[model samples]
Target chain A: MKIQQATLHHLATTESTMDVARNLALQGCPHFTVVVADTQTGGRGRMDRTWHSDPGGLYMTLVLKPDMPAADGLKLTFLASLTLAQTVRRCCDIDAGVKWPNDILVKEKKLAGLLSEMQATGSRIDFVNIGIGINVNNDPARFEPGATSIKAATGATFSREGLLDEFLGALKTGLQNTSLPSVIQQWKTLAVSLGRPVTVVTPRETVTGIAEDVNESGALLVRMSDGDLREICYGDCFHR
Target chain B: MKIQQATLHHLATTESTMDVARNLALQGCPHFTVVVADTQTGGRGRMDRTWHSDPGGLYMTLVLKPDMPAADGLKLTFLASLTLAQTVRRCCDIDAGVKWPNDILVKEKKLAGLLSEMQATGSRIDFVNIGIGINVNNDPARFEPGATSIKAATGATFSREGLLDEFLGALKTGLQNTSLPSVIQQWKTLAVSLGRPVTVVTPRETVTGIAEDVNESGALLVRMSDGDLREICYGDCFHR
Candidate 1:
């Protein structure tokens, strides 16, 4: 939980920053330790899905020891996304919004993505790695389905280092000052999926509900068709 | 989720099988896969603690995609300890009991220990690795304070493969047939810390209470001196 002990490792190319940061976390790395790679050979997303990691994107992973309950894992993810959205807004003129759970989108197009890994002993969480891969200076056509980078969205290239510094600076301040409720309120302001009808798809089942608000743990509290509140902690969400 | 896809790796020495199995799981390895090392160079316990891994001990980790709720991560740990305790009883003829969250002990001595890792996307759990290390045939003098091997306790050598095969066979059956409720009940039967005065230690605070029972999530339900039931999901427990 010592943010002042932050260490940064910049790599030419690696399989994944998350993998490297994971090894560092295993070696008892302090909180806010970071690993950034120019390119990743084996970047991954949720469910072991492949993440396209070309050279122009920003690939970074931060190792954190929150010393909070297990539910704080969810809160960390939301905190990460909120900072990411804010960074995007500051780095570019476009108003970036967060999709429920972990995606950042601008104008209904995918802008950046996040993946997290948690290592724990029973209920005691040891460390969490928040891996972020943002399409910074790449062509949207390289990735699929409405993906846009800063250049693509604004037609002006931006410095990845500038953006990374901005994002991490904001993150350190946010982590130090913001309460969970306040973080949730800020996230609600930049949320694009809340208050909309949405379909969330899991590997096993699909649930459709009115996307209400997220709880303190960053769980999406959905009011289902049966008037029951379902706090979904996992899934791919599509805003309708 | 495919138990049939179980693959076992037996090695003379490795850093940690949990690290090896985690790589496998990240590469989309199927569930129920296992990694066992005859000797480990760097075994680990919870909260960044080092687990001594000399030769003649059973060091193993199972990579499973339970696809359950996040709380099921706790259930998996209890299930592993319960099965391990049962295997020790069957192989060594000594009663083994679980210490609320992590350690399994025989007659107040440490018999085995467990560590778990969970990866998820949102509320969807991707995979969980429950790593277990047992003092099967090691010299108790080599390990410190309260350590006892099955051979040291019963004065008989037990086959490493034999014990592992037995535990896995029983685990497969237990995972398939027994409900979580039944599993909890079985765990309750082997609980040594329950129904007694205990102290729980977290990073920030300590609490003393009666170890009433664990809930469905394998969280210890402590009846505090304040006459309230506190559901403790994380901490080190000491029985008084």
Candidate 2:
């Protein structure tokens, strides 16, 4: 289905786009509503990690109200990462690959991070806020090691508005292909974490295995050393 | 591992025990920390549904910090439900059975409702609060059509503190048996949703099938009429 028309809310500064966008969503904001901020003081990533939101970076949250099961909500993360990588490749002429879940890596250096939070009743989702922190002109490497920005990678400053517009367009088109099998198939084409030896650390236990593939629900399927396959729904993945 | 000592926080009245217990959990309260309220002005169930927290009911929340992934956090709901059923059987002589996720049913009538909320960093769970509202001496049938209390079921008044104490003791023992297979196995013995035709309404779709069994993570497995088996992770199960 065609996504609703994009509604943009630009803020000079905010605590976090996720909070602002969540408030708007709870107040019955339409789907695809966007909240962008110049900077954030309390930006957060997956697992409640702090996200460095420098002034030159593009920090935004997209409010989505998809008519899908809460379990399928994580598929949007994969869709987003794939679309972002494609967007980066098209707009900046830089080849970007996606790490498992939703991290964009340009030549094995972090370019963008995505965090999705949802509130659901039973299996139905009320709304999901996809918080995105893309290091465009900001020097993320100064604060976080192994981080890279578009300007640092290409040595040319790009317009944040143009990049956001291009990304939104691509995402709007991507939302039309929301089927599980097709989305997972398309995402695997840009995945960098698959077909590699990796260690995934969850709260319960750590599993070291070959990153074989991702399931239709977007869970990482790993082939362990003991001939057992482990499906990691969510974890901190490290490529060994 | 041995469970921690019990810590109680009794309130004459509160907005909700979940909020109070969440604050306590965030403030580093010990595991098995208990927060009880004589009445709740703003009680809530799963999916943000308003919980009818009238007087003469046992309303409480348990703070747990299990060293498990967020994916496996739902297992705690099953564990809680099973323990609650056992508690009712032993204390009130009422044969309580669990309905799918976490509702306690006595003779096909609702006796209690359980809601669990958690916060995690990646797959690591920081804390989980299990909110429980059980009808003790209260006439829940006055408000909820299909709900019953211990008094209504057995024609005898029971002490709220006694029920809470028994449940906590049972839960402490249950915490010792946290293995996935064992917890799911024990939970299955008291499950009323299994081996029956159930209509599950999720946020995405409505699935109707014969409930076969529960997986290790406490997800319900259903055999569809189309000869396909579907694993429902979270949904509202209605017996047909």
Q: Identify the leading candidate in terms of DockQ.
A: 1
Docking class of 1: acceptable
On a 0 to 1 TM-score scale, where does candidate 2 land against the true structure?
Answer: 0.79
After TM-score superposition, the amount by which residue B27's alpha carbon in candidate 2 deviates from its true location, in angstroms, is: 4.5
The number of the candidate with the highest lDDT is 2
Q: Per-residue alpha-carbon lDDT of model 1 for B1-240, expressed as tens digits?
A: 122335787778899998998899889887888998888888998766788888878998999887665544666777888988998888779889999787889889888899888876555557889899999889755767878888888888888888888888888777763355667888888899999999998677788999999877567888999999988878788988
Per-residue lDDT of B119-199 in model 2, one digit per residue for the tens?
Answer: 543334567788999999999899888899999999999988788878888888888775656877988888888889999
